[model samples]
Target: MKVIADENLALTDYFFADLAEIDYRAGRGIQAEDLTAANALLVRSVTKVTPALLEGSAVEFVGSATIGTDHIDLAGLATNHVEVTHAPGCNAQAVAEYVVTAILTLQPERVQAGTDFCLGIVGLGNVGSRLAQLAQRLGWRVIGTDPNVQLPEIENLSFAQLLAESDAISIHVPLTHTGQHATYHLFNTQTFEQMKPACLLINSARGEVVSEQALLNDIAKTQRPVVLDVFEHEPIISRNLLDHLALATPHIAGYSLEGKARGTQMVYQAFCQHFKREASKQFESQLADMPVLFNLKQPLSTQLLPLLPQLYNIRADDQALRAGLNKDGMVDAAHFDYLRKTYPLRREWAAYGDQSF
Candidate 1:
């Protein structure tokens, strides 16, 4: 068997080499011609897999080693008789930590423990729900909005209510273009105007969830601090947006080593199941010595601001993105991809559990 896979999928060969010969390719540049001899395909979000993309190819199974499916045309792939599966919640911890780190960086004043600061979560899926749990545990009043999902503990608010009431809003919805609650450009001018004054805005979800021009205008008008890990025109993002953002990253919010390894493990199991082969139950990256930078003897709420930075200095990510883009003021796709590809994978908070304080 032959497999076409994304070079970025961690442990792609370690897991699949025994099963098939792998043809690794850059995700964004993967094309139909590469699938001619492939029995299975593995991808990250950058590659768009439609039935059209699979036409005349002998590919059967396709797996995305990421949580979201917006980039994949599910119905189309199924209609073409292709077995499709994705690793949902694989990077939930990574993304949740990213949001928490951003919040502490942007508005640490609002997140003191046992506090009543309102945090509005716009989705209740894997990533959003995990974020809500983290924020609530940190003593923030967490409210969520997802018409199709209801977390009994989290007060369900309408999208409008979330906008009007939240002290800081973190977007986690998928980029949908249809349905009653289509999220495409969901945070446009009208919605932005409805938001609480000086409310922090975060979009680690998808770029199209907020209209770029509308966001640019809103930033100018309200001077609201914003954190964006994803951009509408990603890779070719707006430098103006970069200038105004409180924190910006090259869509590496979910790029943790553990997360990537989990995603790869999930897809490998799925591949084994589909092909009727036995799968290994134990999987994950080996551990390293994770040192706690500060004494955690104090109340965590009082020190989250400083503690999280020591664990993962989010500003370093912001500066790196800005440094590359600020050089020529031109859209550099290669540089953007380079940042993600060469990103030194950060370990989640779980890794620090065994650390000697």
Candidate 2:
């Protein structure tokens, strides 16, 4: 069987080694012509899977090694009979670490995250739930609002109520445009008005969840701090928003080594099931070589603060992105994709030997 995979995927060679032929190509640079004779395709978020790209192709299956599917054309894929699968919750820990690190980075010395500190988590999905647990462990009172589910721990408050009560808000909702709880542009002028004047906003979720211009206007008026990992138009971010953000990254919040490996494994499993074949290797064996990073003997805070940078540093990513802007003060699409394509080796918190938490 012939399979075309994104070159940037973590373990394409190891996972698809047994296949008769496997072709790897740059995801964004992949064209419809490339898949004309392929039996399957594997990709990351960068590639848009649509009929236009697959209509005349022999491809029958598509697997995305990432959580978000907004980049994929689900309707078109279904109409074309191209089976699709994606890895959800694969990078939950990495993303949770990012949010926590951002909070600490924003106020490294001044922020005492005790019971008095209120953090509002906008979505209670995989990433949000993990973040809530981390925040609670740090002594923050966490309140959440997700109209979709009825979880006991998450206090079902209106989005407006959550904003008013939170000192900082982290958005983790999916991108949707039409519904009672449509999250597209959910954090607009009216929503910002209900927020605390000094609130810090963090968006590691889909970018369109917040209206770009509205967020800009709100930040200009309130002087609120914002940390943005995803943008409305990725690889073509707004310089105005870039300048205003406290932290800016090129959508690498979920690019931890462990996460990427797991994502590959998940999609590999789907590929195997689709073709009715056994997996060539075991995931646990693949991860055996990763080094352990933590010892539980020291004080939690003492160990965590120093260990944070070792796992991943929010500032380093921010600095890297800021350094790539051209003379016209804009990060071209190529440079933006290059940043993610060449991201450093970052491991998740769980990879450091503290799996019990």
Candidate 3:
């Protein structure tokens, strides 16, 4: 079998040689002509798989090493008899850690003793649920809103209630088309108007799920801060929005080294299952190691913002990207690709050594 992998995917020679005949290219400029002879295509979020891109190709299987499949045209692939698979919840902890860090960073004042605060998790899926658990462990009152999950322990609340009552609200819902009860610009003008002026808003999930205009307007109206890891147009992030936000990242919330390894392993396992190959045993050993959270000798106080950044300095990555792009002009697609391809080594909390404080 011949396989073509997106350059951003970090599969080594050992991995590709073990699986199939592989051709890897870094640029996401994969034209149909490029894949005319390949049977399997491995891609990340950068490549858009559509009929126009693969109409005359011999590709049979496509796998995306990322949580969101918004970049993949699933229906079109189905119509063309090409099977597509994506790694869902592969970076749950990575995103959860980022959200937690953002919360701590934005609300340092709330770290004092005997201060009770509520964390509003907009969606209670893999990432949201994990985030809720972590928030509870950190002594925050956790409330979740997901019409799909009817758990007795997770207090289900209306979207409006979450916005109005939460001290910090973190969005984890997927972006869907209109008419869906779950989400589609769910955090628009009305919802933002209801939110507490002191509340800090976070969006690690899809960007368009929260209306950009509404978010800007809301930020203008309140002193409450907003932290964004994802944006509406992606690589073409809104300069106005970035300048206004307290913390802004280039949708790398789930791009930890550990997360990428997990995503690759997940897809590899699925491929082995589909082909009934003995590749499972080899794939098991290839599982990437997650970053260890250095154990603190003594339990630190609730003021974790400073400590957390030292442990996982997300801002450094953000600043580096901004600097590389000059932060003063439109970054071309090639520049964006370079930024992602040469991304910094962001490991999960579990990958660090013993903690100092």
Candidate 4:
């Protein structure tokens, strides 16, 4: 058996040599010619697995180590009899942590006073649900908007109601067709116009789910501020939006160490199931520890941002990408892979303890 693994995937070395002859390369610029003899191809979000890349290849199976599959050509893979799997909900906690931190940073005064504020979770999936729990724990009113979910007790509301009532909105929906009220450009001009002017928008979901130009226009037209962790064109963000937005990060909102390790173990389990092999004992035991929150007598208002990076350094990723602008496409691919494989230690909010400082 032969397998080609994207270099960006976490813990590639641990799983690569176990099953088959492995060919590892950076995800971008990977052509079909490279996998002509491969039975399986593993990748992250950076690689686009289209028909053009698989038509002439001997590849039969595809695996992605991330949640979003917008970059994968699912229809083409199915037509070609190529099986594919993705690690869904693998980074839910990481994204939830980011949302909580952003809420604290954006509205420190409200958080300090424990004043109630509306948090509209646009999608009540894994990440959104986790975030709602955190918001509720912090004494915030949580309103969810997911047309797909049919729960009797959870307060489900219309998208317009969420927009008008929420003081802050966080998106966590997938990008799909419109039949199920798909999330592609879900927050466009009309939706933005309907939002409260004082609203703070956070997009950790797919980029196209929120229109870039429309967000920019809305920010210019109103007091609505945004904190974007995903952009319409990744690795190439809009300059105008960056300058105006309160927070702009590379797509690392869910790239915490715990998240990446969970993704790695999930794929490993999937691979084990495929071969009918007993899952590794170490794999089951290697779960990352949750964050610890330090209880303070007084709310640490001034120490929030400075202390946050200790748990998850948001700015380090920003600076790292900014430093690598001059690299070629292949170099860019290598850099991205390096960042993921050598990802820094990221802990959840609960990981910080009294001794954290």
Best model number under lDDT: 1
Q: Taking the tens digit of each residue's C-alpha lDDT, what string does model 3 give over 1-357?
A: 788888777553555567788888763687788888888888888788887887777787888888888778889889888888888888888898898877666666655422378888998988898887667656678888887764465667977787778888998877778555757788888888888887888998988888888888888878568888777766676457666788877677887776777777777767766667765434336545645544455333443555686667767766655654445655445655677787774766665653311
- The better candidate by lDDT, 2 or 4, is 2
Instruction: Please give, for residues 7-37, the per-residue lDDT of candidate 2 as tens digits.
Output: 8788777888886389989899999999888
Overall local distance difference test of candidate 3: 0.74
- The whole-model lDDT of each prediction reads 0.85, 0.84, 0.74, 0.74
Clashes of 3: 10
Q: Would you list the clashing residue pairs of candidate 4?
A: 291-350, 291-351, 292-350, 292-351, 292-352
Residue 190 error, candidate 3, Å: 1.5
Candidate 4 per-residue lDDT over residues 1-357, each given as its tens digit:
888888766665666567778888878767888988988888888889988898778887788889878889999889998878888888898898788777766666656444368888998877888777666656677888888774343468998999999888999998876675877889999999898998999998988888888888898889577888777876564445566778766677897666776676777677767757676634324545555555655344434545775666565665565454443321153454466556664765545553211
1 or 3: which has the higher TM-score? Answer: 1
lDDT of 1: 0.85
lDDT of 1 at 300: 48
lDDT of predicted model 2 = 0.84
* Alpha-carbon runs more than 4 Å astray in model 2: 109-111, 288-293, 297-299
